[model samples]
Target: MNQERFKTLQIRLSGLSNWLITLAVIGILISIGLGWLVKGILILIVVIVITPILLILGVQWWLKRNLIQDKCPVCSQEFPAFNTTQFQCPNCGEPLKVEAGHFSRLTPPGTIDVQAVDVSVQQLED
Candidate 1:
């Protein structure tokens, strides 16, 4: 288990480094392409302006698709599950939080009588 985890970490680090290098190479290529073409505005625009933006976008795509680890919503720690509500965060014991659902209602009517929060938070009157 420890070896597997170590390998996973190593792979993640390697991927990050690779993406950074790719950005650098794209930058160099853009500069060279601009110098070679010398198409004035178009050259500057395509190589100087567009390539870096594309590099940034590509890095984002790669990280989102390949690298980001799933995190526990409550404790904000990386864990294995893809969805929230699988279990309480093991580290913090807080129930896993989930994104708001469509028309999500906090409490069903008639389930509990909610009094003013300023009042005692004891169980609602039956």
Candidate 2:
């Protein structure tokens, strides 16, 4: 999935996870109020063990999916997002520059256009 969809999924998952924890808390409270001691303990155990695991796994996948992976036009080889800000390519040592993208409200909905701008003449050596 694309980035925006992935972000939306993360948000949704966050909300769902929060809602689940809240429900578990409510269930525990209700069970205790009704004197269902065994039911309350079981619900507490499941919540304490399961909810955090699901949240951690979801966050891990979200982060992995967001890492930038692209082939360099110069070398025709792939590099990880960790090197995006470096001035030169890891393989060919060709000069590179990193720039952040900006959003335009004028653009169409549900799309982002990544355009390269010429900043090669900066005083900083390539």
Candidate 3:
């Protein structure tokens, strides 16, 4: 998956998870209002128990799907990365950008270049 698609998917997943949690909370509140205290507690327990497991599994699946094994363009150091588009090279510490599953060194900003000139000064004796 490309970076843009991956980012969209990530945002969608975040929204979905938020909706699911909201729904769970509403359900628990409704159960408590109906005097089903035990049921509400049970639902809370289930959510607490299952949410982390589901999140872990989901992240694992995402990693497996988007993991890329490639070499850093500047240092040729091979490493694995998710399809996040930009990251630092572990071995070379160079900022790397990814496109089409290929890595390249990220260039500094254009404004970084500054003109330099030698200065000369004459001092008179005090």
Candidate 4:
């Protein structure tokens, strides 16, 4: 399968797992309220055991999909770009914008230049 399709599948699976877990928890609660303490405990135990595994797998998939190698435009240094559009280059401290899997330097704001001049005043005699 292509990378994009695989990533999309991973996201969908993660959401499905979350919904399943929610339903399981609700079932456990209902079982306990209905006086099936042992059944509820077993289901709770199963959920507790499975949740961490699903969470770890989901996080691994997300990190792999979101973190990408990118080169800084100013310094040409390569770094991992997380899920963000704007970031600063670590090597040269330049602000950068990410678009279409490419990095570009951001334009700095314009500033007005000011100059100081000294003036001499003549005193008027009455």
Q: Which candidate gets the maximum TM-score versus the true structure?
A: 4
- Residue-level lDDT of model 2, residues 52-93, one tens digit each, is 999999988876765556665566667665323444567876
**RMSD (CA, Å), each prediction:** 19.6, 23.1, 23.0, 20.1
Q: What is the C-alpha lDDT of each candidate?
A: 0.58, 0.65, 0.83, 0.82
What lDDT score goes with residue 120 in model 3? 94
Candidates 2 and 4, the one with greater lDDT: 4
Poorest 10 consecutive residues by lDDT, candidate 2: 98-107
Comparing 1 and 4 by TM-score, which wins? 4
> Cα miss at 22, model 4 (Å)?
29
Q: Report RMSD for candidate 2.
A: 23.1
Count of backbone collisions within predicted model 1: 0
Which pairs of residues collide in model 4? Answer: none
In candidate 3, position 108 carries an lDDT of: 75
Regions of model 1 farther than 4 Å from truth:
1-41, 71-126
Give candidate 4 regions above 4 Å deviation: 1-35, 108-126
Candidate 1 lDDT by residue in tens digits, 1-126: 689999989989997998999778767867877434434645677788788889999988865554324555444666543323334555766554334321112334586645556665577787
Candidate 3, residue 91: the lDDT equals 96
Pairs of residues clashing in candidate 2: none
lDDT of residue 88 for candidate 3 = 91
Better of 3 and 4 by lDDT: 3
Cα lDDT of candidate 2 equals: 0.65
Model 1 clashing residue pairs (backbone)? none
Model 1 TM-score on a 0 to 1 scale = 0.25
